[model samples]
Each structure stands twice: as C-alpha cells, then as structure tokens.
Target: MKTWILPALGTLVCWGFWAFIPKLTTRYISPMSAMVYESMGAMVIGAIVLAVLHFRPDVSGKGIFLALATGMLGMAGGLCFLFAVRSGKVSVVAMFTSLSPLITIALGYLLLNETITLKEGLGILTAFIAIYLFSAS
Candidate 1:
C-alpha cells in the first residue's frame, strides 16, 4: 500500500492539472498547437531532469517511437477534449470524460492481464454511477 500511495497521489495531481490544461490552452492557441507546445514542453522538462540527475535518457529506436506515439495520442486526446469543452457544456464534457478511467481499467484487463478485485470492481461501478449522475443534463 505504501508503494502505491505516492504514485497514486502523483498521478492524481498530474491528472488534476492536465484536465484543466485544455481549457486554459483554448484561450490562447489552437488546440493542435497547444498540444504540440505541451508535448514539447514535457520533452524539454524531462530532458532537463534527466541531465540534472546525470541519467542518460533512453534514445533507443523502440523507446523513441513509443514516446512519440504516446505524445501524438495525448495531443489528439487533448484536442478532442478542447473541442468537447468548447462546443458543449463544460460540466457535461467533464463528467463524460471522467469515465475515461473505465476505459483504462478495461484496457488493463484486456492487454495487461490485470485482475479487478471485488473492491476495485465496486469502485469502478461507483465511478460509473457518479459519471452518469454528473453527465445527466
């Protein structure tokens, strides 16, 4: 539990800020441009941190390809989110997107062979309920 707690907290913090980033970016730049800038910023920061730590960054072909692919997917997701927030009600878009964890969980199960215990299954169900309630317009 101790091992998981900090990572979970960090992820929550990252996601909390990430969720608002699209809304903020839409104010200044086009969604695609905003995403590009965000990805570039992330890369720069990551490189700086590695340099500071005297750690060599992974530059293998597979790693580079995977990172680039992930960045593209993230940018696409951000663009879609920006469009959703701009064209529809923010609350509705947010509430619907909040259900994204369900997709992650499903993918984990399918691709990673991760098992969902009873408690986790219940939590997922609760999350779905909350999403449904919040998304109801």
Candidate 2:
C-alpha cells in the first residue's frame, strides 16, 4: 500500500466527520456560536501539537505569513460552511461544498502551471454538471 493512500483515506474519514458534526452543532445554536466552540476544540488540538513539538518549529517569514493567511481564509470559509449547513440539507450542502477541489485545480493550473490531462478535463466537466444539478430547486 502507498503511504499517501493511508493518510488520504484518513483525511476522507476525518473530513466526513467534520462535515457531519457541524450539522449537529448548528441544530442547537447559532452558527457563529457553534464556530466559537469549534475554535476551542481546534485550540485544544493545536495546543497538543505545540507541546509535542516543544513549542517550536522551523520558521520562515513568508511561510509564517502564508500560514496565517491560510488560517484566516479557512476560518472565514468554515463560518460560511456553518451558515450553509444551518440553512440547507447537510447532504446537499456537503456535496456542493465538496466542489472546493475544483477551485484548487483551477488555481493550481493557473498559478502553479499544473497540468490537467484529458481525463481530468472530463472530470471537471462532470463536476460542472453536478454543480448544475445540485443548484436546481
């Protein structure tokens, strides 16, 4: 078995739980309130990682800046996701939001000069069709 496959599968399981759990939280409180509690949970994990690393890691100015920016963008998107889960069916909303990989593919192609093969192009087209279907009332 490939090393990456294990971690990738772990990501799939973890993110699946992450998506469903927020739906449960938003049922009881405002999305913003749920996000606050979510941040606390995140902090607990962050603190454990920090302690494991002895509170230090290799650092660079550009890396630090980009990491912070990523956190900000992720938190903003997460809050929007909470709002979406609160208002929409969790299954549909989760499927729609999962198309975020399309954005990553586009950005990688444009900014990182990544190649998209014919198969990938077909997949992208299928994603567009899925988006259309998901958007339908």
Candidate 3:
C-alpha cells in the first residue's frame, strides 16, 4: 500500500468531522468565542503529542519559525471560516473553502517548480467549474 493512503484517509475522516463540528459550535456562541474554545481543544491534542514525544520534537530555528507561521495562517483562516459558517450555509462554505488546494497547486507550480501534468491541469480546471456550479446552487 502507498504510505500516504492511511494518513490521507485519516485526514478525510478528521476533517469531515472538523468541517461539521464548528457549525454546531457556532450555534451556541459567537464565532470569536467558538474559535477560542476551538483553539483550546487543539491545544489539548498538542499537549498529548508533546507528552508522547517526551517533550522533544525534532526542530531547527527556521523550521520552528515556518511551523509557527503556518499555525498563525491556519488560525487566521479558521477565524474567517468561523465567521463564514456563522453567516453562510455550511454546505456552500465548506465546499468552497475545500478548494483551497488550488492555491497550494498554484504555489507549488510557481515557487517549487512542481509540474502539473495535462490531467492535473484538467483536474484544476474542473475543480473551478465545480466551485462555480456549487456556489450557484
């Protein structure tokens, strides 16, 4: 089996829940409040990982900086998602936000010189079309 399959499936399942649980949360509290509690929940998980790793994680200063920056960007996006879910249909919001991979593809091509094959390019185009159709509903 491919090594990435299990982790990819795990992401699919966890994020399926992740996409859902927040909408449920915003029902009872403000988006900002929900985000606060959400961050706390994530911290608990992080704490467990730290303990499992014996409080030692492989690191470098640049890697640490990049990781922290990633967290900040994720949190910023999460806050935006919270507000979006609060005001928009979660179905549309979730589907639309899920297209974030397009940005990654663009960045990979532009910055990392990753090649997109014809099939992958078609996939990207199809994804954009799907997004338009999905949002129009």
Each prediction's TM-score versus the true structure: 0.76, 0.94, 0.97
Which residue ranges in model 2 land beyond 4 Å of their true spot?
Answer: none
Show model 1 residue runs off by greater than 4 Å: 53-55, 59-64
- lDDT of model 1, residue 43: 82
lDDT of 3 by residue, 1-137 (tens): 99999999999999888887788889999989988998999899999999999999988999999999999998899999999988788988999999999999999999999999999999999998998999998
Residues 23-109 of candidate 2 have per-residue lDDT tens digits of 898889999998898889988988999999999976999999998899889888899999999989888888899999999999999
Q: Lowest-scoring 10 consecutive residues by lDDT in candidate 2?
A: 128-137
Residue 93 lDDT, candidate 1, scale 0-100: 79
Among the numbered candidates, top TM-score falls to 3
Error of 1 at 32 (Å): 2.5
C-alpha lDDT score of every prediction, in listed order: 0.80, 0.91, 0.92
The global Cα lDDT (0 to 1) of model 1 is 0.80
The deviation in Å at residue 100 for candidate 3 is: 0.5
